[model samples]
Target: MDLTGYPTDFVADLGFPGAARRFLERRARHWPRLFLNGVPLDDTALGGWQLPEEPDTSESSILGFARDAAMEQHWEDEGYALDDTGEGPFALFYSRYGRPLRAGAITGVAGVPEQVAESVESIGLMLSGFFVVSLLTPDDPATDPFSESVLRDLRESFAE
Candidate 1:
């Protein structure tokens, strides 16, 4: 079960020890469908580093993506569909009140998936349904509701 000749401690190198460990443990449990579109984009080398395709702006953008009308319009500028929800960019992420946001295109999926993934895993339980993360650090008590199993499943499914 060695990966692409990569070292075992690859996730740690990316400053994502927790995420790396999570991915390794869960890769075998989730449906492989999540991996179909997602690439084998792990960066175990260089100290568990996975190169990011976009600049890390999760903190600033997450809210904007969720609440800002102007920004949401821009998200649609690229033809990303906007769900009827009053919310901004994330309205399209789900049909329910709070589902984890899902992006179709890789770039549209995220500007920085690693950062977003960590943010989501570390503190996204408070959100109603499972959701993606992008620098949104909710209160641990409020957000830590998601089960480890759920997060692990997503990481494995989305592991590149």
Candidate 2:
């Protein structure tokens, strides 16, 4: 959660095949909530908030709508942009505004608890360049020891 310790320059390394999955597998449980490209990974994390149905959109397009809605919630200011090259599921993940999403912005999303939103910070990763994985973690390492520890762990794992 602490950006001071995050290796922002190495963010693109996360796009390596299986890197995102391994990272999530080891650290996702420590997060209050997780999202994939703006879509909540766990519906319960939203406290039962359901995506509103669009009158003209079909069921199949609901996922896209959900992604857009979620992105609009916090990504309006500064967020990572993933450039999908459509070449074997590899995309480039880079900061659009050179900063992470703020807690105030994350709280604006429907169903996110205030405490959870305030206590957590946002981190985005590109999964094999196919999709984006966003994680909400504690803002301080002291609040959640595992939060800071994972940065080192991930860097080592990714290096391999």
Which is the leading candidate under lDDT? 2
The whole-model lDDT of each prediction reads 0.29, 0.33
**Against the true structure, what is each candidate's TM-score?**
0.21, 0.29
Error of 2 at 28 (Å): 1.6
Q: Which 10-residue window in model 2 sums to the lowest lDDT?
A: 83-92
Per-residue lDDT over 14-65 for candidate 1, one digit per residue giving the tens place of the 0 to 100 score: 2233443344334323322122111232333323533233333322111112
- Scored by Cα lDDT, where does model 2 land? 0.33
In candidate 2, stretches whose alpha carbon ends up further than 4 angstroms from where it belongs are 1-7, 11-15, 43-150
Prediction 1 global C-alpha lDDT: 0.29
RMSD of each: 18.7, 18.7
Model 1 clashes, total count: 9
lDDT of 2 by residue, 78-143 (tens): 232221221010112322122332223322322347766656435332233222223222223344
